[model samples]
Target: MAAVTAMLEELRDMVPLTAEGAAGRFAVQEWTPEGKSRDGVETSWHKDGIRGWIQKFRSGAVRVSFAVWIRDVDESGCFDALDAVYEQGEQALATFLPGIEHSPLTGHLAEAELTATDKDEFIAAREWTLDERVLTAGVVQQDTDLPVMVVVALEEPAPASA
Candidate 1:
């Protein structure tokens, strides 16, 4: 969850979409892309396991998808807005690749499409498979029966014990 949150924050900063604040332009979510208005964009991500035994040892790739919908009062305005958003989104994601590689993600942009279009709105989407190595799930336990040791020291040894 931390990784996802951080990634989303980074994305929100990189892109023009709005995830927080009053003048929000788009909605962002993890694992689900529903419940958002048709006039705004939505981002959803999921983990897809790669075929290999070693995948169990490391973090698997995460497929982050963006669903963009633009709306306007007029058909022409809507089409223009959709085109602008789509182009900006494409460029923003491309510019974000270098940062992704330096962060927890390793892969590049994989796919993109304008999945739907209508008179007053359009839907554009893009996907990137990130090679994240951090574990987002599971837990580890340590044996409580193991021996324990504690050491306490004071600065200057408490003035040499006065």
Candidate 2:
């Protein structure tokens, strides 16, 4: 949990995030597309620009993600948009995990072939072996104003044996 909290702070520097004051220690209330952090400030979207937050998790896992939304994206710029999201995800992951920064991600949507994961959602991801845990950087593709959500999933370590 400490790591998660620390990352949240780190993300604040890279991009706007839910305010711990209103969102509580590590949680943020749902927000709107126009931009609204639980902190009562618009920290989510920026007129089709960069947006980010600490994703709510049910289990003992925590993840931080950020993306840039471009309105009116045609097929011509789909791949570029995907790569844009991927870039953000890679950058966010590097914020906490400095070691992986120098080592470029293995999977890249621009270079690798990918199929639609959902109706209109295309996804790309890569894994990094970080000690006893695994770090991942993923991007989700959407239609219209494409939303590139790059997720940096960080999970809580296992508890010691009793």
Candidate 3:
């Protein structure tokens, strides 16, 4: 979730389109297996935890896929717009290496491709994936042994009254 949030923040800052008359506006949404359309960029992510020798140390990698849909009057211009958005997104992720808030152990653009296109609606869908390792806090342990001691107190009784 942290990685997703970081990616969303990065993508949300993109210009969306690089064409005249285009909306130049976009939205970033998290995608699920059964999600509907909303007219912007949709993203889905999966994380895999990596096992280490140390039990307290935590590490994992997150793979995020992004989909962007652009609508324009000209078919060719729509493709161009999609290209621009895709390029921008790639650049953003590339610069976002080493992670964001979570301090990813490693980050890079995994794959990018023009998954789908629709000329009738002048819409294009570009999907890309980013792989990154999550940062985790270090664990510390301490042990100690000490000798035990006990003390006893005695009270003196007064002589019986005559």
Candidate 4:
């Protein structure tokens, strides 16, 4: 998981300033409508603005890196408003991860032992090749005027078996 750690450090640098040490590690682009009020006074509604932050990191060999896209209304208690968004994103990532039989080792799969079993079963049980190093992650929250990005850190994986 050294790759994961390196990405986390890079993300730490990407964190937006307003995260108040929350460390977003993302790129933020906010969009909102500018309009005039009843008195013809110009104003931009912070809550009306659509704010989003995206974080992505990938290394030379590894294909996929942990990523998060957060979009929400900017206002007091916005964190409360984004609770569902965070939960949904987290759950989706969890669902896409590989299973045990498929990920027993890192980057290499167990050789397809030739067994005189049903061809269908053999094919079904076959594992897809992928980085098997388990990634561990953490998040940190912040309070700032700009979009917040929770810092995500990954734990290093054990050395792979030769």
TM-scores of all candidate predictions against the true structure: 0.25, 0.37, 0.21, 0.26
lDDT of 4 by residue, 26-136 (tens): 222122324423223222212222222222223212112232323343566566665654564455334433332233333333333323432332111222322332232
Weakest lDDT window of 10 consecutive positions for candidate 4: 15-24
**Which whole-number lDDT from 0 to 100 does residue 29 have in model 4?**
16
Tens-place lDDT per residue, model 2, 26-116, is 2332223453554353334321244445443344333444443223334566677656655665564446344334333222112222224
lDDT of 3 by residue, 1-162 (tens): 243334344433333211110111112232222222123322212222211110111221122222221112234446566455445534444343323323331243333443232122112222223332212121111111211111000111222346
Worst 10 residues of 3 by lDDT: 147-156
Clashes of 3: 0
- Clashes by residue pair, model 3: none
For TM-score, candidate 3 versus 4, the one ahead is 4
Alpha-carbon lDDT of model 1: 0.27
* Deviation in Å, model 4, residue 100 alpha carbon: 8.9
lDDT: worst 10-residue window of model 2 = 106-115
What ranking of all candidate models by TM-score puts the best one first? 2, 4, 1, 3
Q: Please, what is the whole-model Cα lDDT of each candidate in the order they appear?
A: 0.27, 0.40, 0.26, 0.30
Better of 2 and 4 by TM-score: 2
Better of 2 and 4 by lDDT: 2
Clashing pairs in 4: 15-25, 24-149
**Candidate 1 wrongly placed segments (more than 4 Å):** 1-78, 107-162
Judging by lDDT against the true structure, name the best candidate: 2
Q: Which candidate leads the pack in TM-score?
A: 2
